[model samples]
Target: MKEISTLRLAKELERSERTIFTVKELTSQIKDLLENRFLLVWVEGEISQLKNHDSGHIFFSLKDEEALLKVIMFRERARELPFPLREGLQVLCFGRISVYPPRGEYRLIVQRIEPRGLGSLQLAFEALKRELAARGYFDEARKKSLPAYPERVAVVTSISGAALHDFLRVARERWQAEILIYPVRVQGEGAAEDIARAIDNLNRMKDLDLIVITRGGGSLEDLWAFNERIVAEAVFRSRIPVVSAVGHEVDYTICDFVADLRAPTPTAAAQQIFPDRKQLIEDLDFRRRRLFELISERLRKLERELHHLSKRLKSPEKLIQETGERVQDLEARLRKALAHQFFLKENRFRNLVRHLEAVSPLAVLSRGYSVTRKLPEKIVIRKAREVRTGEFVEILLEEGRLEARVERIHPDNHLF
Candidate 1:
């Protein structure tokens, strides 16, 4: 019965009219369908599992809460991105869907990409900020300090703009400095290069104390020149201190972070770099008064000390008389000390003389004792055997020395 059932199922399968397809054939059809259907479509989703390949291609998953799609950007398209693509970043991609035949999977072939909420300019700004920070371009240690009193300032801005006028007015009100207006476009094409060149030129000048890169407040698009990497690099490389006054207080740019100082506005920049002449004069006057007070107090203190010293001081004549009395006392004491020292020296001399006389050989010779020494050698004979027979000898008597011949050396026993 099982064989009959198998036979009947095989016959039914052969009779049925159904199309059969290989995996490759089916995948090719799907690839064509997806590529045609999704041509030039836009997709918005959060990025995930991002992979930046060494070949400059980027691969990632685009995911919404409900579904996930595989995405790919080739080297050429990826290179055009102003910012790096990262995981979890929401992005809008324009591409066509295509299927991989081997894996039987469909993915987006992205031709263009952008951050979801941020414009290209803002994306570029953030990207550059991170890069420059990593390069230490915004380090506090590298930023120069503004001079206390700037002697010469070079302003890089458009002369026709209100920013230049505002800066000049504030500068004139504050301090008298040499204002060198290096006019350059503050926005639009070629503005960043122009500003960078102006900075470099100002740095080459001999006596420029500060360089102010300023512009009137505007939208981010209108103020993009200051946000450029060229401007930031110029500000970083400048030998003279840089003041970035690009916009209103709320606006910020790359130049602001890299500059030595950031001022809210052009007018505020001038106020910051220049001293207030009126305030300085007031301060000098106050210091002069304080100095005068200090001098007067010091003189008073010295005068009081002098008066106290004068009261304790004796007259010259009285001082001389007392000095003479002291000299007389010192002279008497010196004479008494000298007499005592002489007496002690004389007693010491007498004792030394008596002791020397007791040990003198002349004293022994005068008491009938003689000293005999061999001639030529002059060796004193301590024993009778010390003298050689027939040798010449010197005999020291009480009054004089005599030369004699030694006839014999007597035995010591015979002498006893």
Candidate 2:
């Protein structure tokens, strides 16, 4: 059917009376014309419907108050979008127009998409900030604390950048510290990766007390490397505290949120990390003077006490007499105490002897009580049940032991 139609159209055109085209030929021509003419165009509209395919293609409708246009974005272009596209979002789409022959439809093939009211970079920054914030990257509790006095510090930044010079000048002047500069690209391609790697390497060293990731003031694009997720993650994972001093005072980045300290500028970062030597010296001197005064006051108090004590002192002869009297009195008291203690001990010993006699079996035997034991075993028989008939038993008295044979066995419950 297609061939027949092509032939008919060709015959019609050859007659010179009219020009005709088959459906496929016409659609092809339209596709070519639209693609070539509108190679690049920008369209602004509110997204009404969006569909994402498994093939990573996006199909959506862009509609305004007056018109609606179908849009399609392929995988390569769609992946570059920093923020998600959704229905009811107003956006500016940049792409070319193309026609599909099978469906006989024309749609815009988008290469880029940006939120209508904001720049692409700004929108991207905001999107990333929200994502990382949700993951606790920007939490204050998660941020590390900077060193009070850093002996060794690392500055991860472009060696040639002005930030390094400013930081070093202020740091050197304020305090004595070991400064280690790790050179890296501050911006442009691969800058984020370089900064992250430097941070990881410095952390591995374990000698640095503080790390300062800094860059000079520049446009948003120029400062974007510091805002990357890789740099933010590196700063978050660092064992040593990190100080972020990127761009000017008004500038802020993801690194600033994730760092232990955020400095408005590179010079400020230095000031925070290093203490002023002159101030410290003055403080130490003041403390020393105060300590000296305190010691002098304590000594004067001791002298006063000594003087008071000396005034209470007596003549040597009188002191000796008084001491002799005290010794005599103590000796008298000691004699009396010894006699009293001896009397108490004598009474205690007599009482102990009485208690011992109360429990002594010999004393009981002397009182006419007898103890009996089975012969040969020598075990004291407390009950008649313990001795059987015809068993020889020994009787213990205060004077002598007598042996006898048990004639019968009997148990005395009342005696027990």
Candidate 3:
């Protein structure tokens, strides 16, 4: 029986006709290892053979210097990642170590991937810079808000670096610009995180009008502290417009692109931001002179108008001469009126004389007419009834008057 068992074991363990575990048992064991038996873990690795399957699963390899391990993250886990994963980049893999049931091959079911060193972070920085710059966030038009008069400027820089001293000396000399240092490490291990925190703290400062998130200029590698995605984001998102003077002007970085304004150096940033006292005074004087010149020119023009029209002012002598001329004209009109009146009076006198000659009793006397009157009656005796016999009578002759006594009277033959 033992010999039979040995022969049966050799046949069952054949490579071509190998006796394998049943599919259900194998899968059940895999589920137990992945969910219950094995510990959840994080692994360090580089990436390779990256495949984003149509079914929404990501497949890749995590490799070290000697060997490699396969990894897979479902769409559910892969999508939560902030950045894309690529081949040959080192990353810290977070997930459970497990195996596929069918092939019995081991792989990490990745829950998250945190990139190692600066490679992954640099990729993020470059990507974000491109994105924000595309949206005009880094535009010159968006830059603003120099303090009305900035006496205090808060510096978020490293105490270990030359930034604090350089900033203080130059800023003070230029404008007596004051500095309040929020000292932090500008490079190495946890530098980016500290820098971001420092920036946040300084932004809360009440006395500070403006903030300079700067450091002494350095090479691309030496300036890894500034190139960090966290630091760049902090600078970009600051409410107080940040002046980033991180590196030389020629060496443009992601921070330079995202900051409100970029200065070539720390000293240049200070000088550029602070107001110049002399220049402001000159501008004020220039405006005052312009205003005075305008007022003087207007007054001079009014004076010239008054001078040009001096001959137009009225005088008493001129008024008297004009009045005399008017009086002379009135005298000529009066003379003409008097002449007209004399002519009219002469004509009226001639008419009156002719009328008197025609109707006067003296004219009638010259025509041989007489008016007879009864003296006793004092009436004209044109008829006999007015006379009595033996009455005295008077005659009104043409040229003379006569008196008579009536001896007899005949009424029928009374004619005088």
Candidate 4:
């Protein structure tokens, strides 16, 4: 009975050894079962231990109150997320279960993720808008003014879009200008990057006066490229003035806020940048007419003043003839006055000569009187005492003079 029992135990041991497996083989079997069973699934959890690698891969753990699951997003999937991932954020993830054979671990290979309540795209838009506002990207002072008359313009848009056609039509109607098309993708993956690169490239050219970034209306997802921070930064950094004409009037994007000017539509953007050609021509014509009117009025005023002056002016020949007649009259009057004056002067001269003769001693001498004076001194002798005895004396007449010696001196009775 003991020998039979030992042989039965040996058979049981051999069967058990045949079914046993190594650690790698057992893990591989578990991996195959989990992967096949959970090919695609939706897991809701709060993110934790989030690690974003420089290689563009994201590693994290999704945990709830009682359980936690390891998760990873490769670079290709990670870049598709519009909003940034943070710790403790409640998210819904769609992915397949994957096993790391080397570590004997299972994790979720996330294909897509979304925030629990608000849409991820909307959340991203709001978050980026706030960040850019804080950095002064939306400051009115920093915005450049669009040219009143844009001579050269560069448009960034898809060639096939209706936005380009609308803009071209409006611009052509309003003004004559050089339009440069800088074609780029308006929506889809890498659209934002493509737009930004186009903006940067257009800025390199020296001749562009303005940049117009335009696209037709679409859903939020379709219009998302304009809301990207990359595109906003490109608009902000541009030296050339930028106009954002991205959608219908109701839809607003980050690019609209950051651009120098925002238009309701592509047509409106063209209208704002270019002046009306016909109106400008009319204005120039009006100014020209006004200038001519002013010149005519000035000439007419000067002609009237010249006419008034001519009326006051005298003929030179007539003035000279009048002056000669007056001179002749003055000469005749002067001669008559001189003759009357000379006759009066001659009568006065004769009366003066008679008065001088009445008082002249020479006339008295001519009437037989003489004047005697002491000799040598020739002093007049008014009385006999003026001469001394034995002194020579002289006598004067009108025409002759005599000299004699005084024999004696005498005194008159009136002197006693």
TM-score of each: 0.64, 0.58, 0.53, 0.55
- On TM-score, the leading prediction is 1
Say which candidate scores most in lDDT: 4
Candidate 2 residue spans exceeding 4 A from truth: 1-118, 313-320, 330-416
**Which candidate would rank higher by lDDT, 2 or 3?**
2
lDDT tens digits, residues 1-416, model 1? 23668878788789868678988988888888878877889999989999999999999999999999999999988765545677677878889888988787889999876556546557667887898889998999988889999888899999899999999998999999999999998877678879999999888899888899999999887887887767887888899999999899999998999999999998899888999999999999999999999999999999999999999999999999999999999999999999999999999999999999999999999999999898889999888777778899899999988999987667757645
In the predicted model 3, the residue pairs found to clash are: none
Tens-place lDDT per residue, model 4, 1-416, is 24668878789887845777899999999999999999999999989999999999999999999999999999998866645787777788999999999899999999987666446557767877887888999999999987788889999999999999999998999899999998899998679889999999999999789999999999777898898767987899999999999999998999999999999999999989899999899999999999999999999999999999999988999889988899999999999999999999999999999999988998899988899998798888898877778998889988889989988777865645
lDDT of 4 at 188: 81
Instruction: Tell me the tens digit of each residue's lDDT in model 2 across 1-416.
Output: 23558878788777956667999999999999999999999999888789999999999999998889999999987765545676777788999998989999999999877666536567667777888788898888877777788899999998898999999999999999999999999987678879999999998896779889999999887887887777887888988899999999999988898898999999999988899999999999999999999999999999999999999988899989999999999999999999999999999999999999999999999999999998899999887778789999999999999999988776756645
Task: Give the range of the ten consecutive residues with the poorest summed lDDT in model 2.
Answer: 114-123
Worst 10 residues of 3 by lDDT: 78-87
Question: Candidate 1: where is the Cα deviation over 4 Å?
Answer: 1-118, 351-416
The 0-to-1 C-alpha lDDT of every candidate, in the order given, reads 0.88, 0.88, 0.77, 0.90
- Which rank order by TM-score, best down to worst? 1, 2, 4, 3
Which scores higher on lDDT, 1 or 4? 4
Deviation in Å, model 2, residue 15 alpha carbon:
19
- The ten-residue window of minimal lDDT in model 1 covers 112-121
